[model samples]
Target: MRLKNCHNFKDFRKLAESRLPGPIFNYIDGGADDEVTYRNNTSCFDKCDLIPNVLRGVESVDMSVTVMGQKLDLPVYCSPTALQRLFHHKGERAVAAASEKYGTMFGVSSLGTVAMEEIREKHKNPQVFQFYFHKDRGLNRAMLERAKAAGVEVLMLTVDSITGGNRERDLRTGFSIPMQLTLGGMMQFAMKPMWGINYVTHEKFRLPQLESHVDMSGGATSIGRYFTEMLDPTMNWDDVAELAEFWDGEFCLKGIMSGADAKLAADAGCTGVILSNHGGRQLDGSSTAFNQLTEVVEAAGDRLDVMMDGGVQRGTQVLKALSLGAKAVGLGRYYLFPLAAAGQAGVERALGQMRAEIERDMKLMGVTSLDQLTRSNLRFR
Candidate 1:
């Protein structure tokens, strides 16, 4: 299907599947263990229904929201994921340009293919740096300093991924930094020769963010090794609190779930906390972000800007999260699959479809602005 005909998240996913190699596609699409969290992330939204108000005049809609000191024209922002160039040659550049065009924030992963400095220099919109606490304290500090120097608007430390999740799909498909394809995986790549050609023709795969600190250029270090060997599992609130004080601007924690944790984020000087399960990439059966939103919002909503992600697919889903108290929602695989399908054009098309869906849903709900939504406007089924 053409980009214009792409109706929902699954449509863009199909487009990406048709365009990319099976192994590479699964790396982005698959989640840990039985993938229970992955399936439920979006499905949990079905449990809640919107009770619309009819009399309100809905002539003009204003979906703009300011979260963590960044003003987003839309209520949804792109969450950072690693290995973008593997999905599309344009990589983070494609995502940055598309997010800027939509006037939203875009995150750059610590493992992003494009350099943070390059994205900062090119895009005028807000940029977030998704960081990981490393075993080497000096390295972690240096990375933060680099991001600070790049003038990133937010510093999001991902706390859930101290160790890599058990992604069985990767083992079966042989997905890695420098792919070591099994026989089955090689056959899958052969089916998509264009992806292989484009991958080779483009600049060789490199994690520009980690280039200075890590020896990723040598191809000896695998992603699994980086997480298992480098990331510090002993990371605690005190450590992050100190980092927050050090960052000193728009600091947020990215993997928060419980009300207690949310409150801790607020107390630790975090401006915001994202209720996420790392796209279900870590801790497979952990509660979906939507399922735990209400409690977390109640705990820290007044003190901190609360945002959520995982399973957001429709405009109504975005509306539902906002109604429940999320200042904004986040998109992970939503834009990634589109980027894999057709680079910048694909992501732009996906964003356009999402915008239309949100606008149409708002008009149907008889609301002119996002703030008009509240928990009372929803009924749980």
Candidate 2:
């Protein structure tokens, strides 16, 4: 179960489960309601199959792709997830560094434990700042200005999470921000003393992205309250359009699933549209981003980059998405579990494995570059 033994997604997940407490592991593993969408995120890839060609020169494979105006050496980038510090003491710092080593983009969430400025200063690779729309206009503007000042390469506004999803696992385990675990949950943490020791030994956990605007000092506020009270649930296309114009750069809309929404993202002047269902963390029965990819690409691909993330566990799955016209793919738990397993080294290993898988799969498919992948290379079941 050590880092060296971790070669794929399942191995990293098992190692992380063994290393982390039950509640913390579930926080990364659980989904909203019945957890159907979460499971479907990966299962949707099975509905389509890849068709390989033989006798095509493919000794050298180039997996590079340009999505959201960012050139990624691998077609997959690390999607943003909250509370990285909670999972690993190194937090966003580790993810940013590992992704930088691979020459790809890494997203920093508004709920990220580390500040975007710190990540921006430390990493030379392309960075994305993923934030939510706040109820207050001034707060939203301030967040945008802060990210812009930090010189973030991409602005990914998560459009789906106006209100938090009904995460039953959190309720059962009492895993809320500021450590509101139930009695059983408390016992689980006690079972994993190593995690507690690591948590206490590291730097204090604070949502650096929102520390100034939101008063989280002295246990005054919690993440649940922040989502319920701070986020603007009524956010519409107009607000997003203004934010896109304000960012005025490589702006993208994450959590996009439908063709209509993708078209709206293009009309709003977004540079890319990421087809995600928040890793099935929100809207339990919502369609998997992969299921909606072709429609969205047809609707808006001509105008903007169409990317997808969810259930992308294998390199062959990444190829399937690309063959269907995804500019790039995003990885959530695929990297998070590795981060939890062994910090920076674990993340680097996961990224390296993915790159190797993509390279091998590309050669097997008789393609030397990503552009060689097309709908013709795929067969839907």
Candidate 3:
């Protein structure tokens, strides 16, 4: 019911559901068409079992991992999501601060409500600029240059989402930027007066990430248009390679789901590849990232730091991904729901719980450090 009561992902989700309006909650909860991929993202983890070797005299646990040249205290980082301010007034501010406290990396989306520069100035942790290849080549170059100037440590280009997925939940609820809410959607907002009050009472809502380049006023651009009209559907390895060369730092691909593509990412000079399906928000019935981690790791793990983000709900799940050779994992809704339930406090609690879970699970698994995990520590069902 409250922040303190929120002990895990499901707890945070429950709290978020209680606090947020119907349309807003569904936006975070829903995925592509039937959401089968979204459900499987977590369910796939069930097929893989963690074979812990107990009684190894494990006392203190070290769960640190280095990915994309950033050393993270925990193996999990907050995967970027858009419209955080709408979920909680603190927006990306809370997420940035919490991730810093945990000594891990956190990403800020191109559609993030807060500016990357502002977050950069506040925290010393490695920050990611989640880039989207746009139709305007100049805009793309400018955005990359801007992040370069701001000193972002990593460039995570989301390759899968050339266009937005078919999210039917938004259609039913009428959730949009300026809120062309249907009668039912308006009523849902009316019921959550506290959220509205907090929203209005705090800073005015605006996507500082894209306000300068994109005109969002007068209902000109919603997420739908931003994807269909603005993003470049012609994006390819050449484009990604050029961007990686331009960055000339730690560059990662976020939507790669196949081993061949992971190999191409390595050949393209990418430092890392994250097996993700856009949290099942883009493509439905796609293979879960967890299911594809082994193939990817086998194909490109030697050359590129292979990571994944999907359907991870517990510390054991994180361990499972690591056992399969994921350099790290990214957390999306696991942190967003808590951000919605509370503000910085909520995020901090969620990260704290995750750290504790990882540590506890590591000790229980009879491992003192992350290197102790291996494919030998797993049994596939």
Best by TM-score: 2
Model 3: residue 256 alpha-carbon error in angstroms: 0.3
Model 2 weakest 10-residue run by lDDT: 215-224
Q: What value does the lDDT take at residue 331 in candidate 1? A: 96
For model 3, what is the C-alpha lDDT against the true structure?
A: 0.90
Q: Which stretches of model 2 miss by more than 4 angstroms?
A: 218-222
Q: How many backbone clashes does candidate 3 have?
A: 2
lDDT of 3 at 303: 93
Error of 1 at 24 (Å): 0.9
For candidate 2, give the lDDT: 0.91
lDDT per residue (tens digit) for residues 46-120 in model 1: 989999989787887988998998899999999988889989999999999999999999999998999999999
TM-score attained by model 3: 0.97
User: Candidate 1 — which pairs collide?
Assistant: 41-311, 42-311
Clashing pairs in 3: 41-311, 42-311
lDDT per residue for candidate 2 within 184-248, as digits (tens), equals 99999999999999999988878989888877755625655777788888999999899988888
